[model samples]
Target: MTSDSAALPGERADFLQTLDTHRGFLRYTVRDLTDEQAARRTTVSELCLGGLIKHVSGVEARWMRFAVGGAPAMEAAEPGGAVAWEERFRMTEGETLAGLLEAYERVAAETDALVVSLPDLDRVQALPVAPWFEPGATWSVRRVLLHVIAETAQHAGHADIIRESLDGAKTMG
Candidate 1:
């Protein structure tokens, strides 16, 4: 286990800290992006910085609600849910970098608020319909939070590589 996985003062604090770390990674991936650069696909893959931002935000919103046993916010229902890996990375018409960034910020704020209001990370909740996971499996709040962190961190790395290829930018902090 890593230092970040070590026990902390409490579950909520630890979960939030992990989330914040991943969020920082995501933010860094899109740092210094211009509107055109963010939406540009530099690789054979369809991924652009803007599309990645939108994807992560959408995941955050869905998972947060799933973890808390709450109905997902209406905006979370957009994009028809669970696009294929290829489709997810693609930038659609009318999907501007600025628009995606704004949506990300909005969804992130809602997620933060929901997590903050929870009393404990051990609360029982249902898992979202992930392709690899069993249907209707339950998870503790802590597990869901950790999953979100892991998911975001992985995608942030992808975004970093794409961003670098787009303009020769370094991924180092």
Candidate 2:
């Protein structure tokens, strides 16, 4: 069983549950794949499973740090930046699926910690300028958490499709 499966239910359990659900889905996406296969760009977009994992990790780190007034330690891609939705899904040779997944786990933990520590949902947080979002707009901690849930769920679906395409692997257990 995964660590998330061990969490107890409570008042804010939904928030933790959201994180765990997406984390589990992400984990299942790379389970049982060899390094080469994990890096394989099966999609026309050149998106590999390993790259997706890294992208998600970077995104979680950035958003959690943003919510808590801390600068994210993860490096961003030059032209597109971190969470570069287009390039984020693309993997380089050096990135193994295992490594990416481990990084993601670390980032997820950090995000969870930040979320749990925040006392106020209404606190304002800054978001970086990106193609899909307005520049300099502030977000609430609750808003950021909800956004994370949405983002992770969307990517988890993508990961499921990509993993299925790689092999006949279904039923992300």
Q: Count the backbone clashes (under 3 Å) in each candidate.
A: 0, 0
lDDT by residue for model 1 over 1-173, one digit each (tens)?
Answer: 12333433566556667777777777877777777888788888777888888788877877777776533432255555555556456567677777777777777667666666677778876555668768887778777778888888898888889988987776675
TM-score: which candidate is best? 2
How do the residues 105-162 of candidate 2 rate in per-residue lDDT, one tens digit apiece? 7777766666565677789855665676687777887887787888878878887888
Ten residues in sequence with the least summed lDDT for candidate 1:
1-10
Global Cα lDDT for candidate 1: 0.72
**Deviation (Å) of 114 in candidate 1:** 1.4
**Deviating ranges (above 4 Å) for candidate 2:** 1-11, 70-87
- What's the residue-level lDDT of 65 in candidate 2? 66
